[model samples]
Target chain A: MQYRISFPHMGKYYIPIKKAMEAFVGNYGEVILPPPITKRTIELGALHSPDFVCVPFKYTLGNFIEALENGANVLFQIAGDCRLGFYSEVQEQILQDLDFDFTFHMMELNGKNAKGLYEVFKAMNPELTLPKVVSTLAVVVRIVYAMDGIEKYIRQNIGFEVEKGGFERIEKQFLAEIATAETMPQAGRIFKKYLKKLKTVALNKPAKPLRVGVVGELYVLMEPFSNYFIEKELAKFGIEVERFITASYLIFSTQHNVKKILKQADGYVSYEIGADGTDSVAKSVVMAKKGYDGIIHLKPFGCTPEVNSIPMVNKISEDFEIPVLYFSFDAQTSETGVKTRLEAFYDMLEMKKRGRAL
Target chain B: MKAYLGVDIGSISTKGVIIDGDNRIIANEYLWTEGNPIAAVKGVVESLQKQIAPEVQVMAVGTTGSARKLIGVVLNAQIVKNEITTHAIGTMSRVPDVRTILEIGGQDSKIILLRNGIVTDYAMNTICAAGTGSFLMSQAKRLGLAIEELGEMALQSENPTRIAARCTVFAESDLVHKAQIGHKKEDIVAGICTAVVNNYLNNVGKGKRILAPIVFQGGVSKNVGVVRAFEQILGHEIYVDEFGHLMGCLGAAVLAKNSGVEQLFDFNIQEVDFVTKGRECELCSNNCEIIYIYRNNEVLDAWGNRCERGLSA
Candidate 1:
């Protein structure tokens, strides 16, 4: 049976995930990237989802439905901390109730019999060996790191580019070129070529530009469409953007450094506050100490972990005297409200900068 | 006699002002938006034009408010700004030492904190539109009272009743239950005002240090009942400028003068036919709704597309 597998979108991480899935599925099936998240996708997701589930649930469920509609027979969802751990089971049940015939695979990261990359790939294709699985996973990890590295550079300098759309044009080339790479060396070479191309993009940066740090829930922070492409909006006003959470950081770095993250928060948060909440608090402290002009906190409406971090983040803002703006998204279709608040926030920052200079 | 023109096109009302180079108000007009900001702005500009002296030429134009971008294009504005900054600038020009601003408009409310004439921190009400001007207007209609009469009636209360102000749905049911149980009408009115003030403080004003010399503005500031409730709760004097409702446009005028870009702002914009059409691009799943502004049947500007594909559409 041809297994047409699909997964939800989360930024450009799809490129790497699709690459890994292709190797895992082998000749058994093909990977179907769900149509890019659109207004219709969100509306369909919200219509069938539980009335007040976190937005990522609705988004992923919508992606699954679209994929199923497009002839996908298998869906993959990764288990997560917070409400995300229970998502796959509920989503599978929801899809079954909708009468779609498909297989649902939920990968667990932590348990007595936790499923790792090799186990997951082997389960999908019994013909796959340990060496091939390990090699493909290595290439996938490199792809994610390169994407994140290039994105970090883009966010800092995109606003100051001498020629408009120059950085974005190169980014599109990077994603397209990296997708065709078959081996680890190919992936590494592609990344280096793009990084050099990105550097050559002429920038008209000022000595001091307005800087803002973004810290928030894992899903909304990573998914640009989910948050109305806010980082791009900030760059339009020439504000240098700094964000700490990335797929690589969360997967490879965060789990082992939970205690260190909490300690770095400087007593603002002492215990694990579930998922990325502690990380959000900790990054705010680091950003504030770094003298960022402002901090933007984003979260899905009623997200427990991110919501839990607000009071502590506010306290940090007060003590550090840095302005923090908070935004909550819930199946939002209108961009006016977000733009209005962002512009006001920018105006305030500019005035504050002028005042300080005086 | 060069003058600056500023227009504030908001959800509820459209306000306009013309000021001399020294920032003295030459002419101003305030009118209801009535769901048609373009027509309302034309009305405001025509009225302001009639009020201005013939020798005073309108130079640079600035726009601020919810519909600022659309109206800015309509007027060939030198600067299109958000209402928060415009309000702060307008208020500071009048009350230079103002440390805080409490503003509640039709659909939104915000708290802006300033120190030494620069905005330090600010927050606008999020998600919930519980205790804004529209909230008061709806409750007034339920009570079979004119919106203007609500403040006078509220001020007459000796013992105000308590109503839930956390959410509009809850507040409405609570108000009905109070009335059903024979709560005095005046007391209920006063309670509603207090509820609006409380909701603003608890939500928009939360976690901020609201220092002294605070100025209150927006459509809600005209309500003496809400103003009194604010005073009773904060225990601080709230100064409502005589030109409180015009502050947004006043700030725009000031910004235009300071922007150093002088364009002849013809009052003849009232005669120009402007229309906006929204087209939803179906090329891909991200169906971006692109808005195109047409002036005299010619495409002037377009926005709201997420990608270049929609630009062509």
Candidate 2:
């Protein structure tokens, strides 16, 4: 029985996910990747989901439905620290109630380290040996770190590429090559080759391109469509982007940096926020110190941690002398509304860079 | 003699302005969008064309507001900008000392902070239309009063009743309940005014500094009741320009003048035919819905594909 497993999409994180699955299954199984989130995806998810739940829930539920339709029997729900823990229980119940035959596995329910993830892998594959799991997990971790590093470079240079779509073309090539790897060593080689190729791309970035830092809720920050392709829009204006939220950040944030965050977020927040609130607070100061022209805080509407972080983020913006634009997105947000605000933001950043005279 | 044309097309209202080389408004027109932006834009264009002097040909065109993109494409505009930038430019051109701009249109409200003729920060009401002009207008109709008279009644109140303005539905029902409780019309109107000011402060104005030397504009700025409510709540004198409702178009005209892009904009384009077609591509699971704009049987532009597979790029 070849078990077909699937995971929801979040930007380029799918690259590392495919590599990990290739390592563990090694041609013994197939992976079912969900289609991109479209209007139909949201409708299906929203129709079955309880209203007022966070936007990511609806998106992941949609992903699950689409994956099931594509002949996947196993579904993985990667929940975060906050209200995300209960998502699988509710989603599984809904999917089962709809009479779908599938095995649901919820991982990282309590933010455990590698051992917890290993347990999940072992449960998924009872024939899996401890040594095999350890080797596969180690390779996957390294792949994630490498992928994140490459993306950082991509984000910095993609905005100023001399040839339009040059960086994106190379990025698509990297994903394709990485997905075909059959072993941990092969994956590492593929990533290294891409890094070398990425460095060769020509970029005509200005001596000092206006810099913008994006900090927000975990899902909203990672997913492009969720926030209306904000990073791409900024790139259109020749602005370099800095983003700290990613799958790697979530994994590393497991041990805790709340104390450092509390110190940085002093006078604004007195305690630790469950999700990316503290991280959002800390990154603002970092962006300010790095002299970014502006910052944008994006989160799905009704997200608690992001809502709580807004006033403090505004305070930070004032103290650091950097402007911050906040966008609370929901299903109801129109594309034109988002586009106009972004253009306005770009206008402000350009004015600030040019020393502010109407 | 060169003239610049600027159009501000929104979901609720459409406004157009034509200005000469001196940035003097030669002609302007304001009309309701009425759920059809293309028709309303055509109406504004025809009106402005008729009003402007024949020798002063339109040299450039600019567009701003929610429907700016569609109208810009249709008019072959030289400049297309968002309302925020246009509003700031327009306010600064008129009120040179303006530090803040509080604008509430038919369904949306925005607060912009400017320092030294540059926008420092800004915020818009997210996912809520409470306290906007349309909200107040509907509430006025429910009270059997003309929307114009509602403001006058609000000013006559000696003691105002309280009504919730966080949500339009809640505010409307709350107004009815207040009226049922035997509250006077003036008091209820005043209460609605205060509630709008408070709602603007808490929602759109959240975490924003409401400084002095603020210019209040947009359709809602015409309401003396809301203006007075804002003055009381903000503890500062709010300045309202005579052309407050036309600022978006005014700014767009200024931007066109500054853009220095020499595009001959002919009003004769009204004789042309334009159509938009939308279709879903079923090649892949992405199922991207592509939109194509055509002019006289020629494909003008196409967009809205997720990947290169579906896109002609």
Candidate 3:
């Protein structure tokens, strides 16, 4: 039996993890989900590591430790920018020092070439044929495409749904169905059906609630784990949530769409926040004028780009007369405090709306 | 007879300044980001709208900051530039003899080394909070002293004690230890100042040749204690311009004036319909989840990219 192992990303950008796992599982056997992330995990990593390492490094290291404890011998990591590429080695050394027995495959280390892909596949399944690897990759690609399409549709329309929990319930069902789906056609059908249902729910003949746009760092905004499930919590308040950040947009549509977005901004904001602050600022203005009630800004602690953009964002808020609630997330942030503030913010908006109507 | 506006957006603050043909400050606003760039810009614009003379229509606008591209798009700014260029231009325009610039803001710190008014080497500590304004603010809060008072109190110290000038955790414990040993509050405050200055020098200003005629700006420039600390460390009387906080905005405005461009624009950014979505970028292993901004139904801008792959700016 082959055990499938994948690390946890801060959010839905888990596609790469999923893709890597699929390739490994096809060659090996069943894939095991990595252990859940927690404060203890982070502590474990921090205790064993240097103090200057970034938070992601520590969290990932903790994740690997937990996965190994759960009998995950095969570890998968994708090499990329920043310290992440180097983290694999450091973490490997740490794990080895702790006397854990495991095999690690670093994808993208030799560059994303055919040879690297073949080597990874071969490492996972020494007896597997090349045809099997190709077929498995094709299936993984299809899954990724379907998942992206479904999520994109959901993001655009989630704010407009007339029935509360309809979109979320469907999304939950869709994720589960796709995870275990046997064929690409089956997953496609499930996606189509859910998309139709979501559209119908969103377009129901009724007045929509006040839409509040959320924008900020991708990790904090999209990953419920990182930001304490802020989006889900916001939805529970009956406020329509509009968010314009997603992985698909960055990877596929950024080159074609950023220019159009810039023109739309029309010189209201001076720059993008960090990497995405510009997008958040432009979207906040659009939502304000589009009759949205407020804007919520989020960012990871120590994010320089967002920090630089705050002044401009405040300017947008003042010019539009829109109230914006800002939150900075770190590992030590208190979830209870965040919830309390969010609830109060919603109440304040509600009171303002009532006063205006009266 | 046309005037231009320049907005400098930084991680810690947003600044806007207006200038006439002769490069005089017509209007300006400085505000804390509080983690909201859109709101911050809106505040700057509203303040500018009120401050601008009724007869002087804003002919052109330029934006520069970490968020310059987004703010530029939102404000219809004609030119957007990096903080280094914007800050240098703004400082050189004010203090032409400025050979070194030391700027410490809320979240980050920068050291600009200049030769003959040209930036030779510069380093920024975007990742550390050890030496920034926020660190000092928090330390002040811990000491139960107002941030404004800490600087003045430090000036009063006859014998400044030494505190750990490394990380926040170490510094905090060190401060407590010194206080427990009956160190005077004034001396402790001075120690804190020295620690912050030392931390900045070690982390951001390391291995860089800091020249004379230094200009210290950014949010931290307001602290007289930090100014004194720098003077003691660098052995030079640092120049803090009357409008030091507004230098970035001034620089952006200067650029706008130099470009000789005119575009009729409204400061009312509230009327525009914008939306944003956040997703993870899975193109490579980086998995950089990006935020996409949209105006109406069209994509307006994108940010939160670790690499330049997803953004044009």
Winning model by lDDT: 1
TM-score of each prediction: 0.97, 0.95, 0.51
Off by over 4 Å in 2: A22-29, A109-114, A180-189, A253-256, A263-267, B284-289, B307-313
Instruction: Name the 10 consecutive residues with the lowest summed lDDT in model 1 chain A.
Output: A108-117
The candidate with the higher lDDT, 2 or 3, is: 2
lDDT tens digits by residue: candidate 3, A107-203: 6622124455666667667875666655555555555666677766665456456666687787777777666655667667877877776677754
DockQ of each: 0.62, 0.66, 0.02
Worst 10 residues of 2 chain A by lDDT: A109-118
Per-prediction fnat: 0.72, 0.72, 0.00
> Which candidate wins on DockQ?
2
Q: In candidate 3, which residue ranges exceed 4 Å CA deviation?
A: A1-358, B273-288, B294-299, B302-313
Per-residue lDDT of A109-165 in model 2, one digit per residue for the tens?
Answer: 232345765566665566666677667666666667667777888888788888898
Per-residue CA lDDT of candidate 3, range B13-123, in tens?
Answer: 888988888778888888877777878888888888888878887888889877777788778787776666677778878887788899988877877665555554455
> Residues B31-107, candidate 1, lDDT per residue (tens digit)?
99999999999999999999988899888999999999999999999999999889988888889899999999999
Clashing pairs in 1: none
User: What DockQ does predicted model 1 obtain?
Assistant: 0.62
**Which pairs of residues clash in candidate 2, taking residues 3 or more apart in a chain or in different chains?**
none
Q: Is the docking of candidate 1 incorrect, acceptable, medium or high quality?
A: medium
Candidate achieving higher TM-score, 1 or 2 = 1
Worst 10 residues of 3 chain B by lDDT: B118-127
Candidate 1 positional error at B251, Å: 1.0
